[model samples]
Target: MGELIQEFNDYRAKMNDVILGKQNKVINRLFNLDTNCYAEGALSTKTKEMLGLVASMVLRCDDCIKYHLGKAHEQGVTTEEMYEIFAVANIVGGTIVIPHTRRAAEYWEELIAQ
Candidate 1:
C-alpha cells in the first residue's frame, strides 16, 4: 500500500512536469475540461467522483481507479458508498470488471485508512 502511494505520487509528479513543460497548452485545456466535468453542476463533486470511480473500474484503468478513489475519499465518500458504486460498475461492465472492482475496493480501503 505504501509502495502504491509512492508510485502514484511519483507518476503524478512526472506527469505534471512533462505536461507543464511540453504540452502546457493542450494539457491545460484538457485539465480544464476535466475540472469542469467534475465541478458542481446538477450533481456534486462527490457524486462525480463516485461516477468516475465506477467508470474507472468498468474501463479497467488502474491509475484512473486510484485517482478517482482518492478524490472520492477526499470528497468524503465512505467505504460503503464505494461498494455501492462497485455494484453498479459490476452490473454494467459484466464479469471482466470483477477484478477491477476488487482493485478499486482495495484502493478505497487504503485511501480511507490513511
Candidate 2:
C-alpha cells in the first residue's frame, strides 16, 4: 500500500509536470474545477472512490484499480461497499466483471488478511 501510494504520487507529479508545461493555466483551472465539483457533489469521497473502482474494474485498468482501491481504503470504504459495487458491476458488465470480480475479491481478502 505504501508502494502504491508512492507510485501514484510519482505518477501525479510526472503528469503534472507534463501537463503544466503544455498548459499550466488550463490544467490548473481544470484541477480547481475538479476539486470544487467533487467537494460540492452529493457523493462523498468514499463513494466516488468506490465508483472509480467499479469503472476501473470494468475497463480493466490495473493502475486505476490499484490507485483507487488504495484511496478507497484511505477514505474508509468498507468491504461491504466494495462487494456491493462489484455486484453492480457484474450486473452491468456481465462476463467482464466475472473475472474482475474474482481478482478484486482476492485482492480484498489479502487486504483483510493483513
Candidate 3:
C-alpha cells in the first residue's frame, strides 16, 4: 500500500479502536448503522460507495472522503466513474468542493498506485 494510504488506514483503525473501546451507546450504534448501511442491497456496494464518495466530497469531510474513496475503489468503482462522482459533487457543492476534489483525486491516485 502507498504510505499515505497505509498511514491513513493505520490511524483510522487505531482511533476507532480507542473510540469504540469507550463503549458509548450512541457512538457505537451510529458506527454500527454506518457499517450496515453500506452492505449490498438493492443498490450494490459499489453504488453505495460512489454515493458515499460524492456525499463526503460535497460535505467537505476529508476523512470521510478518503474512507469512501478507499471503499469505492475496493468495490470496483472505476476511475471514470470516480470522475463522474466528482462531477456530481462539484455540481452540487459548487466552488467550495473543488479543493476537496483535488485532495480526493490525489487520494484516489494513491489508491490506484498501490
Candidate 4:
C-alpha cells in the first residue's frame, strides 16, 4: 500500500481497537450497528456502499469517505460508477465538498493501484 493509504488504515485500526477496548456499551453497540447496516438486505451490499460513500462525502468526513471508498472498491464499483457517485455527492453537498472529493479521488487512486 502507498504510505498515505497504509498510514490511514493503520491509524484507523489502532484507534478502533483502543476505542472498542473501552467496552462502552453505547459505542460498541453503535459500531455493531454500523457493521450490520451494510449487510445484504433490501439493497445489495454494493448499492449500500455507494450510498454510504455519497453520504460520507456530503458529511465531509474524510475517515468515513475512506472507509466507504474501500468498501465500494471491494464491491467492484467501476470508475464510471464512482464518478457518478461523486457527482451526486457534489450536487447535494455543494462546493464545500469539492475539497473532500479531491481527497476521495486520491484515496480511490490508492485503492485502485493496490
Candidate 5:
C-alpha cells in the first residue's frame, strides 16, 4: 500500500511539472501580450478552450491537446461537442490533424488508466 501511494504521488508530481512547463512555454513564447491577438481577444473561457483544443489538434501538439482537452472537459464540453470541434478542425486543417488528435486522445486515455 505504501508503495502504491508513493507511485501515485510520483506520477502526480511528474504530471504537474510537465503541465507547468508546457504552459509556460506556450504563454511566454507564442503569446506576446501586445502583438499576439490571442492575448487580446475577449472570447469566453469555453470558446477559448475549444479554440485551443482545435489548434492543438491541428498542430499535432500532443501535450497541448491533452491539456486543452482536459480543460474543455472541466469547462463542461461534452464528447459530442468535442467531436464537432474535431470535425471543424479536420475541415480546416486536413486529414493529418485528425489522426494526431486521435493519438493524443488515446494517450490521454492511457494516462487516465495509469
Candidate 6:
C-alpha cells in the first residue's frame, strides 16, 4: 500500500513535469477542461470525482482510477461513498470490474491512511 501511494505520487509528479514542460499548450487545455468539469457546482467536486472513479473502473483504466481516487480523497469523499461508487461500477462493468473494485478500495484505504 505504501508502495502504491509512492508510485502514484511519483507518476503524478512525472506527469506534471512532462505535461508542463513538453506539451504545455495542448495538455494545459485538457487540464483546463478537467478543472472545469470537476469544479464545484450543483454536484460538488467530491461527487464528480466519485463519478470519475466509477467511470475509470468501468473503462478498466488503472491510471484514471488512481488519479480520480486521489482527487476524490482530496475532496473529502468517505469510504462508504467509495463502496457505493464501486457497487455502481461493478453493476455496469459486470464481473470484470471486481478486481478493479478491489484495487480501487485499496487505493482509497491507502489515501485515507495518509
Q: In model 1, which range of ten residues has the least summed lDDT?
A: 105-114
TM-score of 5: 0.60
**Model 2, global lDDT:** 0.73
lDDT of 4 by residue, 1-114 (tens): 877788988999999999999999999999999999999999999999999999999999999999999999999999899999999999999999999999999999999999
lDDT of 3 at 87: 96
Candidate 1 on 8-106: residue-level lDDT in tens?
979988987788778668788888798799998899999999899888888999888888888887899877788888899999989999988777776
Clashes of 4: 0
lDDT of 6: 0.87
TM-score of 1: 0.89
Error of 2 at 50 (Å): 1.7
Error of 3 at 19 (Å): 0.5
Error of 6 at 104 (Å): 1.1
Regions more than 4 Å wrong, model 1: none
Worst 10 residues of 3 by lDDT: 72-81
lDDT of each residue in 1-114, candidate 2, tens digit only: 444356666998798788877877877899777556445268887778787888888887766676667677778778888788888877777787687778677666655554
In model 6, residue pairs whose N, Cα or C atoms come closer than 3 Å (at least 3 residues apart or on different chains), thus clashing, are none
Better of 1 and 2 by TM-score: 1
Candidate 2: TM-score? 0.64
RMSD of 4: 0.7
Per-residue lDDT for 18-58 in model 3, tens only? 99999999999999999999999999988899989888888
Q: Each candidate's lDDT (Cα)?
A: 0.83, 0.73, 0.94, 0.95, 0.67, 0.87
Which number leads on lDDT? Answer: 4
Candidate 5 lDDT, tens digit per residue, 1-114? Answer: 234334554775697677666778666554454124433257767788889878888887766676676667667776678779888888888988868767655644544343
TM-scores of all candidate predictions against the true structure: 0.89, 0.64, 0.98, 0.97, 0.60, 0.87
